[model samples]
Target: MAVMDDSRLAEELRLTIGRLVRTVRAVDTMPPGEAAVLGYLDRGGPLTTAEIAQQRGVSHQSAAKTVKGLLTQGLVRVEAHPDDGRKLLLTLTPAGHDRLAEERRRRADRLGRAINAVLTPDERKTLEAALPLLSRLSTHGTGE
Candidate 1:
């Protein structure tokens, strides 16, 4: 196989991934910021607003606003921090988990339909084989 230029490959992958994310997210009604906070909590467990901000690389005010919106929607609950009396931690409620699961199912169905309708058998096999590489690329520098 001919080697592709590194920068060109990166740009192609970046654009493709962004498009994929947008397509998947189109089924959900939640605002991006609110959904993001919920997704972070779903993966990372309970965290303070400050921790969420730091993890997301956003300003504290931005994180706080996101958390507040989630709170208003009953998607997340805030509890007093176990180790700190003055701080609060945010966690996903049962409804939030259900919403996440439903959103995932919808996205999966949409993507699966698109793939089946558009891609050949060989292309499907190629995508199946690429899953691990894509996962690794996403986590490469995160120290996960």
Candidate 2:
């Protein structure tokens, strides 16, 4: 029997995980794009639509659409940038923060249950130990 290459196995695992993530539901009234924008705001504080687009790797027009949707939903508000009167800065409302927190909690619970189901105690320990390396891989573009 031949062993599979590590890189091939990792690619398969990443694809499977991505598919699974796409299926999970977020507990927000907003659409996925709006929710993603809110999540980014929750993490990064106030930012302009262009900045959000850059961070999300999307076109400014797409980000503007998302911002408009979020503004309509009352999940975010726009204010004149103090330093730049021509630009607007977007920030989450209190309701948006609450919604984001709830969504995060729901996702965490779902992930915890799934992790508990498939992983043995020792495997769980190993995963916990490997989390930092995995996080680095995720953040540093090494995993892809």
Q: Which candidate number has the best TM-score? A: 1
What candidate 2 gets wrong by more than 4 Å, as runs, is: 1-6, 23-29, 141-144
Q: Write the per-residue lDDT of candidate 1 for residues 38-58, one digit (tens) a residue.
A: 889999999999999998899
lDDT of 2 by residue, 41-79 (tens): 988889999999998899999999989888887889999
Question: Which pairs of residues collide in candidate 2?
Answer: none
Model 2 residue 98 lDDT score: 85
Clashes found in each candidate (C-alpha, N, C closer than 3 A) = 0, 0
- For each candidate, the alpha-carbon lDDT, in order, equals 0.89, 0.85
Q: Where does candidate 1 stray beyond 4 Å?
A: none
TM-scores for every candidate against the unseen true structure: 0.92, 0.84
